[model samples]
Target: MQVHIRYFSVYGSTQTYAEHLAGLLNTSAHPLEVPLPDDATPVIALSPVHGPVVQAATYARKIQGRPVAVAAVGMTLLDVAREKDSLRKLVPEHVARFYLPGKLEFSTMSTAHRATLASISTMLRAKPVKSANDKAMIAAMGTDTDRMDFAELQPIVQWVQSLR
Candidate 1:
């Protein structure tokens, strides 16, 4: 089946997941900015959480009425699974939502993001809180290695499989 994997990956975790998934399904992933006019395939909009929201609502708005699924990549996936409000804010009206954790390397962060992180620290009035040790488990490597294990990605994989 033709599938459109449109993603907005800031730190690349979701992009890695999209690439891995595309390889598994033998499809190519596309950027959200490019229009997919002739391809009638359904879409999967993958994004990561930033500050207070998933980093690309404008991109999300672009796919509103299309046949789309959304997966929110974040650090709190396991901890916030039952938080309907957070999940809702991530992927509203999506056919399905997948919670995937994200990783960050301050060195790799864009100047803007680094600045934003610095700003957050100032606001919180604390030494920069690193990605907490408790949340850095292998499973949480979904955020670290910029790769998510296929087994862990199965929920979205199964959903895509079911679509065909």
Candidate 2:
């Protein structure tokens, strides 16, 4: 059971998670890219999921027909079953999925990401009272915040190990 670790991170949380997993698994962590090793080696991809983007999907497309496990890093939480359903069409149906909480660094984001978040925050704040979900989004995107915890990776690591 050979396993490979790969990752794509915009703000470094995903990379950190991948590196930790790599260390624990004693494997190398590669950045998600083409020209990957041609083998039946299963991949554990640590990627971030933003508003409408999920980095793991790109890797999944590139490695079609292979066993791929996705560890999604994000700031928001959603029902795992529902999230899996939403991503099923983009990723392989057999993919093993995991959701890991992520952090936000306003200063580290691209101008476009910052601008887009700001726009959404503005809209959310316009309403005097926000729903819990909206408020959570606003707070996460509105300020520089860190919620990353290595402990959060335990389940993902255990799951990946089992794949081996």
Candidate 3:
């Protein structure tokens, strides 16, 4: 089966994953801004997760009832339970979900995004006790931190192949 790959990326990590997956599947990846090619093509949407938000949720909702899968890329690590809970809140339960690690490139971020991170960093610093994740976030504030791996696309690739 032919599949359509779309990505909504902020700092390019999600796009990188989408393109790599597309290459493996022998398809091309398009930005989410492009309209879907057809009704029957299964869609794999790779979107960045910023804190509580999954950037492509609105697009997913817009294309409801289609064969759609969402790959959420983020820096924060989560247990399986938390991942499920977060996905429930961010997208429709019917949508298949996957999580992938993402990179944070502070240098490439817009001024507004950087300022917002600075604010978040300040709030995190104010906390009396910090989790390991929080400490890592604090340390990565003004630098580029990458957690992406092309091997992580295997599950998505397997799922897409199953559709055939």
* Candidate number achieving the greatest TM-score relative to the actual structure: 3
CA lDDT scores, all candidates in order: 0.64, 0.77, 0.81
Q: Candidate 1 — which residues are off by over 4 angstroms? A: 55-57, 64-66, 81-85, 118-147
lDDT of 3 by residue, 113-157 (tens): 899889999999999999877887799899999988888789888
- Give the local distance difference test score of model 3: 0.81
Residue 25, model 3: Cα distance from true site in angstroms: 0.9
Candidate 2 structure quality by residue, lDDT tens digits, 108-151: 78899989888988998899888776778887875787767788
Best by lDDT: 3
TM-score per candidate, chains pooled: 0.70, 0.83, 0.89
Residue pairs in candidate 1 whose N, alpha carbon or C atoms collide under 3 angstroms:
102-143, 103-143
lDDT ranking from best candidate downward:
3, 2, 1
Model 1 C-alpha lDDT per residue in residues 39-150, reported as the tens digit of each score: 5577777787775676444465556545666777765545454364464664556556667756666667777876775565455444355444333432332132443445
* Better candidate by lDDT, 1 or 3: 3
Worst 10 residues of 2 by lDDT: 77-86
Stretches off by above 4 angstroms in model 3 are 78-85
What TM-score does candidate 1 get on C-alpha atoms? 0.70
